[model samples]
Target: MIDVAELRIGTSGWRYPPWRGDFYPRGLVQRRELEYLSSRMNSAEINGSFYSLQRPERYRAWVEQTPDDFVFAVKGGRFITHLKQLRDVETPLANFFASGVLALGRKLGPILWQLPPRLAFDAERVEAFFKLLPRTSHAAAELAKRHDDKLKAEPHTDPSPRRKLRHAVEVRHPSFAEPESLDLFRKHGIALVVADTAGKFPYIDEMTSEEFAYVRLHGDEELYVSGYSDKALEKWARKIKGWGRDTYVYFDNDVKVEAPKNAIALAELLA
Candidate 1:
């Protein structure tokens, strides 16, 4: 039998200066920002890891700062997605997993791999990358053992073997909107990210995974700037309610400090 789908709503990232005195209360220290955000939202997407590998200590500190039930969706490193372009990334993937990502433990959620706009859909290349992904924590740990000397000094190689992992791909190029791309993702149980980039990226709403659905709302009218209106939130609420699979919605419109407010607004509608 299928389990009841869960809805996790929050922002793409939490550390925003503009949020000070706006979404965040005045005098709230920068370090305590995550602690405050967790009090209201159930999940958040960690985008820093997308830029570079994060140490295990940082991931552990994040877990301690948040509530027990909080979950974090980590963005895969750009070194793997953008630089390598999903080619010959076995060791890069291992290094990423070893670089303390597993420290999040049970609070760890899906791994998001956002493809660059310049990278078009390549079926063979995409399939090969998917094959390299570890299906469970145990497999991830084993893969982590293969990390290069770069992470040998301080790596989080071991993790709980009980939990399974999920991955989702966010595509930008229009080439990914075809049926072939959707079928490829379905064959591998990878969620095709429904990215709302305000006409900046190709938006594909198809659910490729039976396990879950991932959505990123960058903005409604302007990419990373505009806030979602009540009307837009209502429309999204309806769409999410209709998705039978578990859903994760993260607001990425942080430029104008609208992400948190919009996330709360969308969560309220879903509630």
Candidate 2:
């Protein structure tokens, strides 16, 4: 069984002003920022790869800067998962892992495959993609769509290459909050990726399965794009403490300000 207590949480990624100088110097500053942020939080999701391909040397440098227990949850390359929407991108995926990003060992968390809102559930595509993944201990899937009848009736299958890989599903549509959808996730043993968006949308309020709990707090819509708030961080911390399993919380809110500040506060709450 998965131990939820071992879970860690933080923001989806970190960022800095572009006026900071060249990418190298900016990266150096970012490293210092991450070090200070990680000092508080147990883990963070690296969203940078979504913008561009990650170099192995850069991944190695990231490993060198953080604490031993710091886990980096990386978002898969956007071209393969978002733009191309292919089930499998063998060469690119291989290059990514072999590039030293996944070399972090226990420091590596889950590989987030965030499908674009336009990409609906394609069983064949999803099946093919899962087959190509390495049997790592940590892996997850996120779908940013509304749970529809078609997606519901379709057979729920696990095509992941490894038995130990954990699957986490996220639904942005209201249909997913229904009892049937929740039951489906629990039946398949897929953990729900609870997202903190705006308004009265149905966020995952309870653990649907025994698997680890994965959450991405995108912050209030107004604050999300901007990223700063102590009140929100405190509220999220309270929510984390209520979970029974290891929880992964990421602040996908305004990265410019809140990512680092909330990361520090949330870490203190967890600690």
Candidate 3:
């Protein structure tokens, strides 16, 4: 039998107000929402980290909120992907690591680096950024040591090393559909994100990394609005099973509070 233990099903972000009276229990306190979500899902994407560097205490709190088996996939900062465009971002990357991501400890899963829709595929630029990615927590800490003054105030640079870190690149531009992009990601041992974005972006499904596969389900008929039907969920489950590697899937169709529902339903199918 193919081992499904490597599969993790979850939602991109969990703090939606629409989910309050519906998915999340009506009386459940706001602080315990994560605790509630963790009880149902095995994983979640820490998307707030993408907007800005998070504090160490926040990551530590997240560790406490979730179950021991639950994993959190941290999103790479937009400052590195969008603003910096992955150029000369050594310090920015270091600062990101230093800002408390390591505090997640054993619960930390893959790091997702999503490129903007406007950023086309540039082999040299992409490869250069991939070279800077640390494959392990220890290496991340070593890189963290190079962080600038921005993180000097109580930066969580050192935490005992935990599991091997994995990276997944989510490219939006159509230029990334080429085989060369896959080859570059494969060369760096980075998983190419299989994104379902309702035709707004390139939806690539090739498994570039043998280590694992990362998938993001934005929506079905509408971007971040529509929900996946039963057939869609079943198809995804079968595809994940056939991947033959650890796979992480996060539902991003949260505008209608369908992400968690879809994630839970998909997990049942896989189960």
Specify the highest-lDDT model's number: 3
The residue pairs in collision within model 1 are none
Per-residue lDDT over 1-271 for candidate 3, one digit per residue giving the tens place of the 0 to 100 score:
3484488889998999999999998899999999999999899999999999889999999999998999999999999999999999999999999999998888889999999999999999999999999988999999998998886357886757556899999999998989898889889999999999999888898988888999999999899999999999999888988988899999999999999999999988887
* lDDT, candidate 1, 126-234, per-residue tens: 9999999998998999899899977634888777846999999999999998889889999999999999999988778899999999999999999999999999999
For model 3, the stretches where C-alpha displacement exceeds 4 angstroms are 1-5
| C-alpha TM-scores of all predictions | 0.97, 0.70, 0.97
Better of 1 and 3 by lDDT: 3
Candidate 1 deviant stretches above 4 angstroms: 1-3
- CA shift of 45, model 2, Å: 1.3
**lDDT, candidate 2, 1-271, per-residue tens:** 2324576767666555631342224445644866765666678888787666665566667778789988887776777776677654765554445444544555667667665656655545555665565544333121211112322122212223333445455655555556666666676566667777664344557586575777876666543655545676667777766666677777766544565456556767567
Pairs in clash, predicted candidate 3: none
